[model samples]
Target: MRRAISRLKPLWLVPILLGALLGVLGVLDVVPDFVAAVPPPVIVTAIALGVVLFAVHPRAEAHQPHRMAAPVRGRWAALNTPGQQLPSHGSRFLGQYAAVDILRPTTPATPAKLRKAWRNSTPQEYPSFGEAVYAMAPGVVTATWSRSRDHRARNTWQSLVFMLVLEGSLRSVAGRAALLGNHVIVRHADGTAAVYAHLRRGGVAVQKGQQVGVGNQLGEVGNTGNSSEPHLHVHLMDRANPNAAAGLKMTWTDITRSEEIEPSLAEIAKQPEPNAVLSMPRNGEIFEA
Candidate 1:
């Protein structure tokens, strides 16, 4: 009976104590009648304290482990095309794909405009002069596209007016850069595949059946199929076949660490700062997490 009473006592005592406090407050008029009409403050001190704690908490920092014990003795080729000055960075590739401008250009450039005359301006239909793209990881040449003419340039006002009128029809002829035009796919050591896209027509350095090592020149950057600008696109996937390639979350070794958006050609001209590196993934390359 005592054990049962103990539990029941807590249940009854809370309400009784609350009632007694209310009675006392009513008798003493300690609480103003207007107190019932008041609203709670928008920001609570406890909540503010929690937010401060959260802001100061450390974020999750992840690092990849080096793949190879031996340091890779290779360097990435120059990304700029010969005789073609980059408007900004020495590197042709602009903006991050997955992280920045996921499907189209974010600033200064727009996808609609890029698609209007992509055949010439972008590597979607024509390869850039002397821009050799290489295999970042080894796999296969599962897909390729090399049959499209880059559009002719039009700088005049009349030409610009005409180009806008032809936007609807221009889309039919314009190729997709993100579609991995004129590309090669190779199976990576981790069972995933690496895709090299927007290769120059007739610039494919490797045959359909040839085996390539890390940094082996695969082809020149081209605007063969689907691209908005003269740049090379590389990414990792789970499948070798183009139709089935699934994007894999990946990180590269020797890559610059910073949250840079739309880095220009000039920005890429400088070598990696002391103790800094640009991302390049290759076989036998050690990756430190």
Candidate 2:
């Protein structure tokens, strides 16, 4: 019972339902004068409850790093990496505490080309788009989705502002499926799960209940859901249900090369060895596994 309770989201809904009920009663003219006077105190109490819920919400354990194989092959650059900060996506909600985004760098590796690709390229023009996404470890598929259409890139300042202010808000309200786009959830025998998000529409190659080994292809990367561009989003979680799961630290067991690229783009705290056996590439780092 305690475990189940911990898995549940915070009780913010209680105040929301109360507010809605009071509004309905007011519209129906069923609220008495005494009850009409009750709204002020009720609103105050609701605000306090919201504050308490936010303070006490369960957060991911940072020390529990889950080691697995790299989910993609060849050259890739890391972004929003936990190696740079905890709650990598700026929040622990939705099991993204230690999530990472990766994309293939453009050829010639020029700043001009990178900016142009990010600001104006279509999904198919990016190297990472349609590239195979692999299972990080042996697991049974618990969920699969492949219907969300790949949207345009939001890498430019103007588009990013719109995404963060408007589209992101709507996606959050629409829930995990809308935020993650075409995705797959795989649960390992130890109970931890891995999520592969922003997959290409109609690209999912596996179904729920199927077993997958490390390096097995699950789908191709795409610029879907609440993404800024065509990149693969990977994260580990305590469970398969992302709504309740807490994020877990993740590392790659087969990283063969790690190179820091364009430190001006994003800061890099520590330089990982070129051939570290097990590693988590920091932001601005290009790595091969």
Candidate 3:
């Protein structure tokens, strides 16, 4: 059942299901005509959601990632991005569904993992876990939040499911702040705003009105918000409010890609491989700056 729901999530079945339920209620006399009259709205919502779920494909063969300089200094994972993957495949209501979730890959197979997925180790133990998060472009700091507590890193698939369920419910009650923990927003000069979310607790290092430039340190990555592990989430938007912002393209400077299960510090030192230059990494593709 859990797997089924997870699979259905990308399809956005919940809204569609609710819309169906509303239709059934209208026809079965479960609700009054006043309520039934609102069925049009529900049907419209379902149709719109369907288009969002299946119609848009940012990473489609015809599209390409807009490359830029690397945001972080060391190794990081480029998994979900509207420019790189199907997960963030559309531009809809806001940019919430269109942001990139960045992280440094440390796994059960890494030397840091020590051959175990989880054994009471903290995300702080990994070299890339608390690495400094840097500014990608010069911008004014528009918003900042730094109070959500850092939860334990979900080191295993089993634990990750639990983390998702717990965070899912808590988010409904806590709102956007719940999904994006200690975060910072920067409105760039080009009319594009960049958001750095899920920073360490009290890890925010800049003031709301401070000016920041490319390579400026904003915060340290940590396990906060809707993350299962420590990572830095960054995305570009046309609006400061993610709810209504339109997502923009992303590209990283120099990087080297490797599929090594356990990359050594020495191996990571030899970064920006000549062949790996100027490429949008596929999912699970390891890259270092």
Candidate 4:
């Protein structure tokens, strides 16, 4: 029961509560008689919405020991895990993916103060803001995009609410360039494409159709697209076009840990673990490449 609740997003809970509340009100005669016709439709709509939300909810995948070359050098940590947190809720096409954000271990994991006060901050404030992104696997460059603006970090309640309500349509409104921001798609050797997203302006170093080896420089991480801070957003898709592809499972190689785990456990006062191995880094766990 605890685990299930953890998987649910707060915004998704609203409609569910509304549906149940309407049912209770109808039973208690809390509403007007003219409103008698309201409960059934409202209840049904809420149920439908509930099903959609559940269906679209980010997927928590069973961790497989995936071994891939380290995509970035130096010490870094993982946020939004495939272990419990569904990185992104959309699970169809580019949506059915387990996305992970990689940032340097030295960066601020959360807003230093109120979540909203940092809304106008710059990406350079974070350590991972300028770190270079590397190829997850050897493959040819399939596609690239770099048009989104790296607006201030959306740490305010207002921006969070707005993102919950309308962020879904950002990709459609701004084209594929909107959500991922300055991303590159490499046709990975394992029959999937590695999407390197949220890169800095002019950070991309490889071109489309160019062959790259594992660990090749793709670009420096930046605050672009739908990102709230600077970090590398990556996911594996079955096809070159994320919109038409399904997300594939990925396992990291060459991962190791130290005395501390997670950002809050201990001040990760050092770099990532030097010897990389195959494992999943939990939300706060740090790893060095």
Q: Name the best candidate (by TM-score).
A: 2
Residues forming the 10-long window of minimal summed lDDT in candidate 2: 109-118
lDDT of 2 by residue, 22-124 (tens): 7789799897787677659768788567544533324654364677999998888887787666667777666777889888876553223235333555677
* Candidate 2 lDDT (Cα, 0 to 1): 0.76
Off by over 4 Å in 2: 1-6, 10-57, 60-64, 108-120, 262-278
Evaluate all candidate structures by whole-model CA lDDT and list the values in order.
0.40, 0.76, 0.62, 0.65
lDDT of 4 by residue, 13-99 (tens): 466666666678879879666656666777687777764554442233454534577678877777654533444333443533566
lDDT of 1 at 111: 30
Error of 1 at 126 (Å): 12
Distance from true location, Cα of 212 in model 1, Å = 0.7
Tell me the spans in candidate 3 whose CA falls farther than 4 Å from its real position. 1-67, 82-84, 89-98, 107-120, 156-158, 258-278
Ranking by lDDT: 2, 4, 3, 1
Question: lDDT score, residue 40, model 2?
Answer: 91
What does the lDDT read for residue 50 in candidate 2?
52
lDDT of 3 by residue, 155-197 (tens): 6655656666775554533455687788899888876778888
- TM-score, each model? 0.42, 0.78, 0.64, 0.67
lDDT of 1 by residue, 16-100 (tens): 3444455577688786666435442422333444333322211112333222211112222233211112111221111111111
